[model samples]
Target chain A: QQQVKQSPQSLIVQKGGISIINCAYENTAFDYFPWYQQFPGKGPALLIAIRPDVSEKKEGRFTISFNKSAKQFSLHIMDSQPGDSATYFCAASSRNTDKLIFGTGTRLQVFP
Target chain B: DAGVTQSPTHLIKTRGQHVTLRCSPISGHKSVSWYQQVLGQGPQFIFQYYEKEERGRGNFPDRFSARQFPNYSSELNVNALLLGDSALYLCASSPSFGEELFFGEGSRLTVL
Candidate 1:
């Protein structure tokens, strides 16, 4: 079973627009939610992360809004740029396990 | 400081053959995890090791095996490779279990 589900397999946005991606999970034991950005031929880099205790966390232009009760979370990128065009993956993990269950991923493209 | 490093950036093997991939975690990191990413899909958890011990494992078949050294470096071995095994293998490291992970560039395996 897919532990984490992500929507909009691909996305396109104009420069400086707000790009949003959403993800949902079924496991309530998940406590750590993180977003990773991956470029072609490279590894996924840590972008932003949030815990269940916080409803929202923002870093630079990237923001993560998490809803524990709904078992949902979303990533928002403000002022999306062409350089930000890459694949984004959302992941969840529990304290008891070191494995991270990842979403299928969302490919984002920013056009100028 | 150096991030996670993986060896054999690309390899090709015939079906029914065997393959091995290596990884070196960052300094002071005690945990190492392996993931597999098929084309256009997110990474799937394979195994996790902490302090040279196996801490967690995914749902992969018995053909997949891994071990961690005392220095925290890890290796993933696959026996009787299948075409479905072709994918990008990733290694991630963290200071401990269930924390943020730093990923390596990954080793691409192609099964013929």
Candidate 2:
């Protein structure tokens, strides 16, 4: 019953490089897709999110590429920094469901 | 401006004992959700509450229960703790539910 699937349990990226994490979900009803970043002993903070209507969304150093047909989404970090070393999670949910189906998770390490 | 807050950053309990975790949502946030994160795994949804009413639940057993207060704070109670229950219990709050959650640092429960 793993509803959301993520890849690469752990990843290593060099500083100034790019780090990517991917996720796919089984439930098509999922309308909202979000990525969260968590540091040790801290909460999961919202990084960026993309709805099904948008194919892609971008922030300062983060981007969310979404594919509606594939039921997949990915988070890309540009100019990865050592400060970006943390665990990342992808989640899916629909309106009124309240429950968010999360992927296994990916630990990203950006070496300085 | 305060974010979600959790109580007792760490706790130790014996098997068959009980533990209670607390969470206070961000200011003006009305929905509270709970999640469990085991080592090397993603967070699994446990429960959600909106307006002091149950909104959703996950596939956890009956030993886990939660409730929300009028102030949008919530509590999670687990009875008869098992070794498998040793993990980081997370609390999240949102303006509504499903997506856009602000999470707490979490309460780590170690069952012996």
Candidate 3:
């Protein structure tokens, strides 16, 4: 029940293409959802996040689309660049809990 | 302002040995959390500390324990470490509970 399932274990996109990663969770108690980007030999870094109250949120070229009824969320990268090649993770957590359940992760490779 | 910092960026230990990993959260941040990431997998929550008190713990075994100091620095201790315990240990910090999290580079542990 604590798991956050993510899809497309790996992805390949060309520069200027669109990249998308999807995630779903079973725990309805999760009120907070965040996406993290991780690079080789480094820790995961916060990329973008969204809550159930809003259907979507955008930051620069990154956007997060959230669906409350489906218990699913996705991260989209516009005009994907080689610099965007990294592992992306979707995470969920509840205010009542101190832990954030993370997805398996998606390795995104943006080719030039 | 420095980001979260972890000690012993890399280490090796034999099975049944004990090991201690340390983390110093960002200055003025009071909330600290620990996570374990096996290669190619998303991070799994280990423990969370706020105001020097343990606020939450994950499904990890009792062999994994942690404590926070007055300075808000934290330590993760593992006893009878097994080969399965090897992974990247990450420390994240936030201003308070239910907020944005910043993660450090992480400490890589390899058990023999």
Ordered from best to worst DockQ, the candidate numbers read 1, 2, 3
Model 2 misplaced regions, further than 4 Å: none
Q: Fraction of reference contacts reproduced per prediction?
A: 0.89, 0.91, 0.70
TM-score of chain A of each: 0.97, 0.96, 0.97
Q: Which candidate is the best by DockQ?
A: 1
Off by over 4 Å in 3: none
lDDT of 2 at A24: 91
lDDT digits (tens) for residues B2-104 of candidate 3:
9999999999999999999999999999999999999999999999999999999988999999999999999999999999999999999998978888899
lDDT (CA) for every model shown?
0.95, 0.91, 0.95
lDDT per residue for candidate 2 within A1-112, as digits (tens), equals: 4489998789999999999999998887888888999998777888998889999999999999998988889999999999999999999988776587888889999999
* Chain B TM, every candidate: 0.99, 0.98, 0.99
Worst 10 residues of 1 chain A by lDDT: A1-10
DockQ of candidate 2 is 0.80
Is model 3 an incorrect, acceptable, medium or high docking prediction?
medium
User: In candidate 2, which residue pairs clash?
Assistant: none
